[model samples]
Target: MIDPRRLRVLRALAEHGTVTAAARALYMSPSAASQQLAALEAEAGHALLERRGRTVRLTATGAVLAGHAARIAAQLEQAEADLAACSAGLAGEVTIAAFATAITEVVAPALPALRARAPEVRVRVKDAEGPASHRLLADGEVDVAVAVEHPGPLGVGDEQVLLHEPLYAEPFDVVLPQGHRLRADARVDLGALRDDPWITPWPGNPVHDVMVRACEEAGFRPRVACLSDDFRAVCALVAAGTGVSLVPRSALRGGLLGSASGGVVVRSVGGRRPTRRVFTAVRRGSQSHPLLRLALDGLRAQAASLAG
Candidate 1:
């Protein structure tokens, strides 16, 4: 019979390109990972890996086996959850991956309640950005992902593998340097700033897409001046007279009236404002697991508290 442990190593290799990376994820040395793969190939009686010039590529057969390994891993997780459910109150560990503000504003706040509900349920947090959180959830590296909602990447087909639970929608606030033409306005008109140079997140980020689409709907494309993913840095750039940009309301620590002292003014948009929705994603069938369910409910409660 093919060994399940070796299959896990193969699946890790498929998820992470390099054997070194796969070995690191598995917490094994490179030489030991290679030996496991060699043993698996012998069991399968086929060449599963092709090695050339310090790189490794899976053979077609290896890819097929890796796919099976992924399914088997999910099944094992389900089995573990089932067995844990038989024992006691929430008692298993749940690892969640999320970006900065979500951790500070949502996940961290939810923890005290989760601990009160189930002291034995451990929740581990990993720092990950937008797509990386989802990727980690898909690869079985994380049990839950606090991710921003986006199209194309997590489409209908992913429903079979993931269950997305939207937590909140945060509206974008326009951040302008002091003394700009529209700084003193009660609500900034997006169309009036058509000629202004804009700071934006790099292309492909969810926030960047929202900024571009909001500008396009306002009738012109924003002329790009700088790119940064960190909202703090974006605000800093605006303070230095770099350019104006749309920042999510949650990223700013204080309220709109309180955030104007740093040489940058934050104002609401006049027309239809663009917003990004944040959600928690988990494996499809795993949400009902006792520990995971409690964690999800705690997050929802915390999100409601924030919205209030």
Candidate 2:
């Protein structure tokens, strides 16, 4: 019989791509993780890993087994949820991984109501961006993840193991330096900013991708003047006349940059509106648990409030 614990190690190995990374996620030493894999291979009477120097790749049999392990993990979560339903009312801890804006605008705002309604339920929030949050969810590190819509390791095909729920969609606003030529316009034309230096998030960030794609569609590429992932820093640079930028409506609500009274102007873009869609994702088969359900409902309520 396959040991479920060792199978989890194999699943981690497959998800993380390196023994060291897998061990770090599992809170195990590298040697212990390797030992677990070796034991798993012994149980299967097959080589489950192809060692290449310090790195390793899952063998065909190992990959197949890892897939089964994921399904089994989901089933186990379902069993736990079923058991919890029988015990009592909502009373458990739920950890959420979210980006900066969601934490401030959505998750944090919903907490008070959750506390009032179910005082026994606890929530822990972790700050993480989209791709990172998905990894945390897949590794079973977070019970829920608030993420922007983007291509991630946990794609639509993994819906059987995960639940994707759309929370809200907010348009990106054009942020311009004070006294800029385009500030007089109600809706800033993207093409008009082609000549202006751009302040954008560092490459590989979802917001960065949005800026690039929007600019390309606008008939020119953005000439980057500064790169920062922090909206506060981005707004600060824009206020200092470093360059113009794109910011989400949610970030604006967080007061990253003050308002028109501050040394910057925020306006919507012309043509097709570019938006960032935020959503909450949870592990499949566990969404029905009372604690998770309450959390999800609270998040939905907060998102609705933002929309209103």
Candidate 2, 163-219: lDDT as tens digits = 889999998999988879888899988998899999999877888988899999999
Which candidate comes out best when scored by TM-score? 2
User: Model 2 RMSD to the real structure?
Assistant: 1.9
What is the lDDT for 145 in model 2? 96
Candidate 1 residues 1-308, lDDT tens each?
99989988898788778899888878899999999999999999999999999999999999888877776766766787787678766677899999877888889989998999889888999988878787678667899999887755653134545678889988988999987888889899899889999999988677888899899999999999999987878888888898999998888864432334478988999989999899999876676678888888988988886662
What are the clash counts of all predictions, listed in order?
0, 0
**Could you give me the TM-score of model 1 versus the true structure?**
0.85
Off by over 4 Å in 2: 152-160, 259-261
For model 2, what is the C-alpha lDDT against the true structure? 0.87
For model 1, what is the error of residue 220's alpha carbon versus the real structure, in angstroms, after optimal superposition? 3.7
